[model samples]
Target: MNYAPENSESAAAAVSAIRQMIETGKLPADGRLPTERELAAELGCGRRTVRRVLDTLEAEGLIWRKQGKGTFAGQPPDPTGALAAEIAPDADPLVVMEARVCIEPALAELCALRATGEDVQRLRKLAQRASHPMDADTAELWDGALHRAIARIAGNRVMLTAFALLDEVRMGADWQEQRHRARTPETMALYETQHRKIVDAIERRDGAAAFDAMRAHLEALSDNLRTSIRTLDE
Candidate 1:
């Protein structure tokens, strides 16, 4: 893991080394990488430099880091695939929101009907995480996870694939910027409450209630986004 210098050159070298390891089958898909401290020591660099490299890799979807779990190699890109082409870099945030409003409520209804006890438990845990998010970014991440979990519990591969694609679209820089603009502390608190309502409805096995709760949550989010866009325009 020995790298070049302690400058930008070193950071680039670190990224290249890690990328090569992943590409060369040295790091299998979803395989955990060494911890930041270990990487820093091995590469003869500071933790800050390692962190910057990790951040860059994560942002590029080359890797993902869990809060406590170490970073893992991301799934390889499918550049030639329809999904990659569908979610364009400049896709409209409003279009993404509209798609969510249409699809997620139905998914929640299905989840309420189909979810197992384990699914309910996991949903509860995700809701708790969203309730106590550390910052705007963490709040958004948990919020997306909660919705995605509900979609997964619905047990429809088609809907799940659509949801996953929508998620990929959401990871775009434009969408992230728009979401960051909209995610105020007050809005996060409101979303936490809404998330609880949706989870509670699902736990009760009330499909209708779950559908309504999810629809309400997304509608509120859409409103917030509109307000944020207007403010930004102003």
Candidate 2:
């Protein structure tokens, strides 16, 4: 329970030691580290410095602090999954997905850098699970949910927020109607399969494969969007 801060007045080593604790077996995966007070006492450093390092870890999703509970470890989240409940009236559906293609590729690379076993497992669950096969109203929610999962894995809040905003645009009534009308059993099956592949590649830690898989999926989406664009409300 000791995180002895360097009394040496070096800011860098304190941060490095924190990283070492996590990287080493001292702080195992999903295991709770000592309290900030304990760490400060142990490290012989100021509480503020310890808190700062912990703050950085939280931002990276390497750790999570519960409001009433203690801090615990966390896996990285996908950065590109869109999770908005509603799309704006004037939002451009294809452009939203297109923007993902631009940002998510790099996010995937970062995911490759930072992703952990737990993160991979979550992505696997999302990718493998069958989407609800139902009417347009129901299907839209499922569709958005899966897309949002992809964003969640990126482990970057800025990226997640951007994707969420775009998802809002995608969730608009006009876009949903176009997507709903275009939803054939064949298309649904195809999307589900492609989504699975993307997750699989990410899980495998194959950066190129993951990127290509994602690209292919977006290509399919782009086609659908183009064909459905004219049908949306003006």
* Model 2 lDDT tens row, 119-228: 87776665555455457666666556656766777779888788666765555435566667667788788888887787777778877777787778778877877766
Q: How well does each candidate superpose onto the true structure, as a TM-score? A: 0.65, 0.54
| Candidate 1 lDDT, 1-234, residue by residue in tens | 434446898788888888887788776456888889888887777777899999999999988887777788884445434574565655678878898999999999999999998999999999999889787788778877898899999999988888877877777535677788898778888888999999899999999999999999999999999999899999
Residue runs of model 1 more than 4 Å from their true location after superposition: 1-82
Least accurate stretch of 10 residues (summed lDDT) in model 1? Answer: 75-84
Identify the leading candidate in terms of TM-score. 1
Assess the local accuracy of residue 188 in candidate 1 as a C-alpha lDDT between 0 and 100: 80
Best by lDDT: 1
**Global lDDT of each model?**
0.85, 0.68
For model 2, what is the error of residue 73's alpha carbon versus the real structure, in angstroms, after optimal superposition? 36
The per-prediction tally of clashing pairs is 0, 19
After superposing candidate 2 on the true structure, give the runs of residues whose Cα lies further than 4 Å from its correct spot. 1-90, 130-132, 230-234
